[model samples]
Target chain A: MPLSTQSQAEEEQYVLVANLDNARNLSNILKAIGFKDHAIFTATPNGLKVTVEDSKCVQANAFIQADIFQKFTIKEDLVALQVNLTVLLDCLNIFGGSTVAGISTALRMCYRGYGYPLTLFLEEGGVVTVCKINTEEPEEPIDFDFCSSNVTNKVILQSESLKEAFSELDMTSEVLQITMSPSQPYFRLSTFGNSGSAHYDYSKDSDMMELFRCNETQTNRYKMSLLKPSTKALALSCKVSVRTDSRGFLSLQYLVRNDDGQICFVEFFCCPDVEVDEDL
Target chain B: MQCVVTGGNVKVLAKAVHSLSRIGDELYVEPQEDGLALRSVNSSRSAYACFLFAPLFFSRYSIDRGLDFRCKLAVKSVQTVFRSVATLEKTVEKCHVELDKAKDRLTFTLHCKHGLLKTHNLSYQDTESLQAVFDKDSCANVFRAQSRVLVETVVHFPPSVEEVTVAVSSERMWVRNHVEDEAERSKALLTELCLAADEFDHFAVGAPNSITFCLKELRGLLVFAESTGLPVSVYFHEPGSPVVFSVTDSVLEGNFVLATLSDDHNLQKSDSGGGHAEPPPPPPDDFMNDDIDSYLIAMDTSVVPGPSTAPPSAASRASPAADSRTRKHSEEEEEEERDGNEDPGRPPSKKFRSLFFGSVLPPSPQTSTQPVTTQEVLASDSEDEDE
Candidate 1:
């Protein structure tokens, strides 16, 4: 049947508006609500054209209810997490199809609208040099929470080269630590655990618990604290999920360990040209 | 730099079979250039021979006078054999001079009693894009000749001969003069190929031109024949075995040697018969240079016995016997004495020696006109290996 003629009773169209970085996450959430394999196309400006099966028409609207948006908080451990430019540089340095041409092409196609005046720090021969984003400037700097409280979060290996990468980390049987200040945070993580490491101890006395909005429900306030990881414990394997907070910050939350383990987060904001719904 | 005479001067090497009857009814010419072409000619009707028409005048010291460069391109016989000789008949006489220097040229046409036979154009280029090599400064001169001649050649059948001894010769003077050194050239080629050949088995691909295993198999067959002096007949059914060359009717008839060749070689057989079939593209000629040199090592064990058959003329038999007896007796005596002197740990029996020595039939003194000289032996072995 031609899609246009299909009755709203038969199928529904969902317009998903989010930063492209969170496209896959929203897609999955929509899928879980019976919106399986919807025909998805790039939306005009900053939206995704999603066509749901008639069966999912009810489930999708209910899943994207206003309350879910209220529950969402794009949380970044804004202070604890730092955008170590080296990780992006290292990711870029990988040869093969990963040449500068590929990076530049990817930047032009994917990164241009997201940000600009994007300060890049490069270390060459042990000297730190700064690079400014050459293409159009990003509408605003990336918004992140920069809270450094979570001291013990799981190290994740989420790439095709995961096993090989972590074998190189040699992080097992060792106390891990990480420290970050609120001024700048949000590490543009490498696909694998291959690139960076962090270790820290979360003292019981420190502000150990904080409520963070998880995108799924307003009542789903994610609490954060840290526990000392057993040196004898092998690193836990985990999956990642991206959620937008009430404040409209896109946080990459590692839904990591199955039982609501620590959430290591990064925050990204949509391009300013994207007009947020005034009603929110 | 002082010029030293290489101490060896150009000598008449192999003589051309004077008449077509003296050679095979069909002679296959393999030029390094355009693969191989077998030309069929009527032996009784056409007189065939190459004459060296050059160096018409010779000074004991330097440049010879009256030398016919055109005649030097001629084919001739090395022996006073009784046969029909091709004679140069009609000549296009022309001479030119540039700045008072002599440039002489001649064209001769030949005729045979019967009709025309095939002539091959075998020029090849050294480059991938094969173009003729040219001396840009030299004037373009054309020397055209009709190739045919008649001679009443008599076949003097030796009394005890079981097979006809057809005389054959190379058209190229270069091949003739260097036949003795052919093995050396082949050997050098083989050495460079050893590693590549040895590693052939490691490659996943089927054998196309596997240098190593091919050499080993050829060597094995040759060694078996040489060890026993009994002709080694083989029926190779293996798909990978190279069975492109055949020398004796015995090998061809005794077994399925034809079946042993790669499918391509069989295709070549049919292609060979079709007169219009273009020559099979040759393996790179330079490649042959390397292959031949390395293969020369096997030459000692594999030279095909030349035109030797049962019946022998008294004179023809005499010289070969004298040469073989002198050479063989000395070599055997030395080998025997050395056996005694060798350490006991050395393989005590000569059985192993038979593996190599016996397969190579000592040149049959009674029938073979030429002595199996070391050089000739090496050349034959190399050729067999190369093929």
Candidate 2:
């Protein structure tokens, strides 16, 4: 795999199209999903194009989405989650009528959101060092086998016995090292666990990871923030139970303490890898 | 005229003159040379199919309210007339007239070419008078009745839809005669119905029996299923019917869907689509009341079965066997009419006689036996003396 230079990263761009009434509505919706301060772009009659600094984009989007299921309206909760996932699936329905395009390109964007938080460093030979990503369930230590070259582009992890490790803040200070392809100076983080071992995967030549439908089901959860009403980081305390449905289906349920001492429940089942629209 | 193919039913030709009239307006009929041709202007192909198939394939459109009303009118008229004869028979028997061994003679004749609308004025007493007219037709010479009976009935539809009332009545009569037998009467009634159908093929009323509403909530949900990249279940049920349609996510529940019927609020009023007009006063009550009088007269005459009940000496001997069978059948019919009339002598007093036909003039109790008195008796003879 050859590394991408600063010049190469500058040239790459991605286009995003949404049916939102306006950019403000789009910003609000994205912000609810933990996105903030990202550049906002308006769609022209033609389309909207987005340019991003690889490291910054990967870092901002890389946050562990342990709670992605919260994005749906109660009435259309399941449908919303399913659509979000389907959009990520190599734009499955994207090029429905076109037969000429290879299915692989469509397959690549599926799990791209999983890899983020890549390490960034400049090199004189037009090469840059980008960080590797590790995805994991709170109960499982990062498994090295996930990054094996022989493994297929999509992988599913499961556990017979699973339990939540201590919260990330409660753990001893330590940094986990991940390896990228020797030729590429950068690697992207696919996904992360708020607590416990992280998982990593390597692509042959680019920072982009082949899209795959991935999910982690966590249970017995609680969230609390120590900061004041204006500024507070959400604190989650719950037992983690993880599993993935290969057919792009996910079922995750969480328990959190409310103002009352009683535990409240939240359930999530994601149908990821949804077919995307090609006319986007 | 050339025939135009509409769908499966071919339209033979476009009709120039619309003959059938309901109220003031002429009801348009498909020219008999061709079949009927009526279509909605604003609808698409699917809407057209829904309208066409509604009455035939689905039982939703089957009742035919108008025809049902017609049937009720026919049944009531015939039954009341039959009962009137039975009453007259008992009355004659009490009097011990002792005219013939067979029975007291009676005969009944109806001019039903006008169909159910002819009964718009008919009632028990009116029917009795009408029967006297028939009896005169049967034996005016032997009975010493010089005057012939005339029971003329006409069903008048209101000029405007707002006027719900109709008028009916009969003319002059003296004696009651022959009664129609039951099976024969029913067949006659059916024949009249056929005639009415002929009239109705051209009658086009503007209002629809029921309105349909479409479910718009299901629109975005169709695309939502595609997000899963898997099949989602769908359920659909139509209005006014119990049928349900369902499919998996791969197939759409209403894709090949026939759209729901569209309705116009303005359609409820008359086709003129103008604000409702002031209703006209109801048709003359004599129209329907007179018809009822004819029915009663018929019943009174038919109640007594005898040789005199035969059509006439010449015609009776010509068809003696048939006349005897008819007489025997009339006897059975009297029993049935009695059972039916037992429940509601109120049928004579129902508001529809006044509402749809005309305001039925309540018969003066004095005329119950005679049904109708001579106009000369009611008029002063002083004018004759002056002449």
Candidate 3:
């Protein structure tokens, strides 16, 4: 058989296969949600969803549509598996991962049914490397159930505005208190650190603010350590949507544009810290 | 104390700090009215680097009250603050360094052009100041070479070669890989390169000498020189002495000193051979043999403990007897003994005959003389049988 025909024959045995012209497209998006080593991958006919959780209080998910891949095939309705994201990244960038112009690593990922390892073939500049990473039983990710209908307060702003604030946030502060209200101090981010307390306030009518929907004033404090990883997603995003439910559950959705000018989304869900009574 | 460093000079300071951090975990910062000096010494004391930046290098230089203010800070902490020097150079307008004596912390405030301010407060430790003093005039050999040429030459050497021997004579300078073991030395291919004396801008040699030092540290210093685009000047007095590499730019000067391996004890001992009145050169035919004999003697006496464990060689069989006789000759009398062995057709030169004996014979004067005569007789008998 010819080379192409051989690979086509080999691809038939695998239950799922994904091919991308540039491996960095997948690697970069996976990095935005890579706060942990192991990532759960759930693939359906629609697309692929990768979820990573830490401390059971925070969860990050990256969604890559099936259409993003040049060649994506599935033998089953749904294929799920878990693998070490760090190892997968290393395999994807085996060719030194240089971002030089007109050079990229092409990737072909395959997975045979239950007990088989996930195989990756990366080729760059006429050189090829094949890596077989053992997969583990996938762990079911927790659902925050943060429905849009239950969102008490929501606001959409350009990521550039929030990026500045997040970069300058005092890391010494244990928790970051966010207050969204229709009254004065429309959107406020407060931190009490060792040096001093700092407050970054933005008016509702600011040019950076794209959308604002507030039914009631809600104040929630999330652990700074848990929210810190979202900054990675924020740095690559153009727009961000901030939402809080009545139970003080916070959700941040970031719209990221890749090198090809294609749109992707990375969302983060974080549970608020224990509320302290103020009427004492 | 407060001072501000602006413009492209901030990158120079950051690079200096990053380089110093590689030498030691803690950096000693000395602030004088003129400029600042940063110093670090490795744990093994084999390597030391010092960077001196003059006052003219900084845009705004000041001293609070004292003429000299010294403090020790963690290298990692300082490196973390200036991790993004490239970005800082473009956006940052000025960097203000303030020493808060009352608070026992040092604060670095970065003022950006867009009114963005970032502050970092680092804790320091109380440590004694480091002072490295070396006299360049006392060194016997000194040479100045272009950093690019030196770095390009050193890069060709194999990484497995740990120490490199640098031999400088009146005619030329040569660098070769230094092998420690005799057996391995013979098996391994030797890599040596020679450069004409004219290749160096300034070359001076009082005496012909060869010194072996760690190659890895020398490469590091050469890299620093290459980055700064400065000529590297090397100074060395003799074998086993520390070699100093110095580089100077318009704003800063750096000196790196590395210790050399000691290989001159046996050579010195042989030269001083037993208070002899006269030292005569050996005959031409025996010249190669004498060199091998002396090397074997030195290897036996200085490094090896016993002849039984010596490398399997024809000359090693006679080492035990030679070792005992050589022990009697003091350093002061070594020259006389070495000359006494050089007399043509002497019994001492017949030491090569003992290699035929498989067993260790008793040390007897007659037995020592018998082996040479028996070897001659055996040769004649073999000739007769052939006839």
Model 1, A103-168: lDDT tens per residue? 311110112123232332222233333344333321222224423332222222232122222232
Error of 2 at B333 (Å): 30
Answer with 1 or 3, whichever has the higher TM-score: 3
In candidate 3, which residue pairs clash? Answer: B273-B333, B273-B334, B273-B335, B273-B336, B274-B333, B274-B334, B274-B335
What DockQ number belongs to candidate 3?
0.08
lDDT by residue (B110-156, candidate 2, tens digit) is 11111100001221111111101111112111111101101010112
- How are the candidates ranked when ordered by lDDT, highest leading? 3, 1, 2
Q: Could you give candidate 3's per-residue lDDT for residues B285-306 as a string of tens digits? A: 2223353232122111111112
Most accurate candidate by lDDT: 3
Q: lDDT at B339 for candidate 1?
A: 41
TM-score on alpha carbons, each prediction = 0.15, 0.14, 0.57
Relative to the true structure, candidate 1 reaches a TM of 0.15
lDDT of 1 by residue, B56-172 (tens): 211111222332110111111111111111211211011110110131211111111112111111111111100111111121111111111000011122222211101111110
- RMSD, one per candidate, in order: 32.5, 32.7, 19.1
Identify the runs in model 3 with alpha carbons over 4 angstroms from their true place.
Answer: A1-50, A65-254, A258-260, A271-280, B84-94, B109-118, B263-387
Question: Order of all candidates by TM-score, from best down to worst?
Answer: 3, 1, 2
